[model samples]
Target: MRLRVHRRGLFGWEPGEDALAGAAVTTTECRNIDLDRMLDPARGNLVIGARLPHMSLVFDRDARGPGHHLIELDDLTTKSFARLDWPTDSTEPFTISQLGPRRL
Candidate 1:
């Protein structure tokens, strides 16, 4: 599935915490963000990272499958928002920090 961050005030995956949103089944082999989906008209106005909380993206295949995995986004560093040129290629890595008002 496509995993994306939820709005800051939205219900998180766990109690008292923020969560990410997912839709459409897709492999996690591509380590990149779906900017198009993030900027979808129906998803609402884009506020960048300030409106989103840093969260992990868990990838799994059933209860006992081999694809089980997790990506802890808070552990990585990203470029400043002003430095981003808006990567057009879907394959380009998009770190959560890049969505924020400043570099993480």
Candidate 2:
């Protein structure tokens, strides 16, 4: 399943937030954000951080085990949060703050 974000407000809707919400469809297949090379200053320009309330992960039932997982962002920080293990076979949507390692 593909996660998609929908805009509610008139304009300037948050894409990241939308993506997170869409992830709920299949939380099991969704995994943590890959931030291996996101730390690069050059890449930073493409990695725009946003204040998202939640994130969702979509999964395939027949192909996989469970379904998916969702994550809520309480706060924003430039620290790398470890990948969360799902209770069942599922996916989870996460933000950059939830993935990348903390910069010293």
Candidate 3:
């Protein structure tokens, strides 16, 4: 993924346009990201024994601190998934890890 912040928004830092603005900035890119293992429905408990159905692995980005990503696996069935208790809802199938400052 690449990042280039130009201005700060109400919510958080906003991304710049296609081309860089004034000062040339370093485009940070995360290379060779393998999501195969992390995209498994079974990993999120959305799969049953020998009964894998149509599912959707969805993800939403949040530039907020403490949580940068919100990934969820939906079985697409009528059954509803449990709701998260934002403040303290970090558990299995719904966990968060704090990856500190980026290291070269």
Candidate 4:
């Protein structure tokens, strides 16, 4: 699963609230957006931060068990318009933020 932002003006995205189509974000600025603080995975549940309303957290069924589990982000709505395979399992306390119009 992967985290994807919905296309602006589509369903969940309103016209003025849509992501800047071709805006570019610097890598330095990207580092400031904290995924852990946003998701708060340590709280024993999924948390959606105010800044990233379009993103969602996903986990495999096994992850729901009683343990520090690895999971995946649902990428069905990614800017790429496709999902990415989890090359390796991802543990909690990770961050995902949109750095630019097409970069996440």
Worst 10 residues of 2 by lDDT: 2-11
Clash count (model 2, backbone only): 19
Which structure among the candidates has the greatest lDDT?
Answer: 4
Regions more than 4 Å wrong, model 2: 1-67, 70-75, 87-98, 101-104
Candidate 2: residue 32 Cα off by (Å) = 19
How much does candidate 2 score in TM-score? 0.18
Which window of 10 residues has the lowest lDDT sum in candidate 3? Answer: 2-11
RMSD of each: 15.2, 14.9, 17.6, 10.8
> For residues 21-81, what per-residue lDDT tens digits would candidate 1 score against the true structure?
2211223333324434544435522443335444332222222334322222221223112
| Overall local distance difference test of candidate 2 | 0.29
**Tens digits of lDDT, candidate 2, 1-104:** 22121222222322363444433222233333333233233452123222232222222222323433322222123322222323233233432223333311
Q: Where's the lowest-lDDT run of ten residues in candidate 1?
A: 75-84
Which residue pairs clash in candidate 1? 12-19, 49-99
30-65: candidate 4 lDDT, tens digit per residue = 221242343355542343322445543444333435
Better of 2 and 3 by TM-score: 3
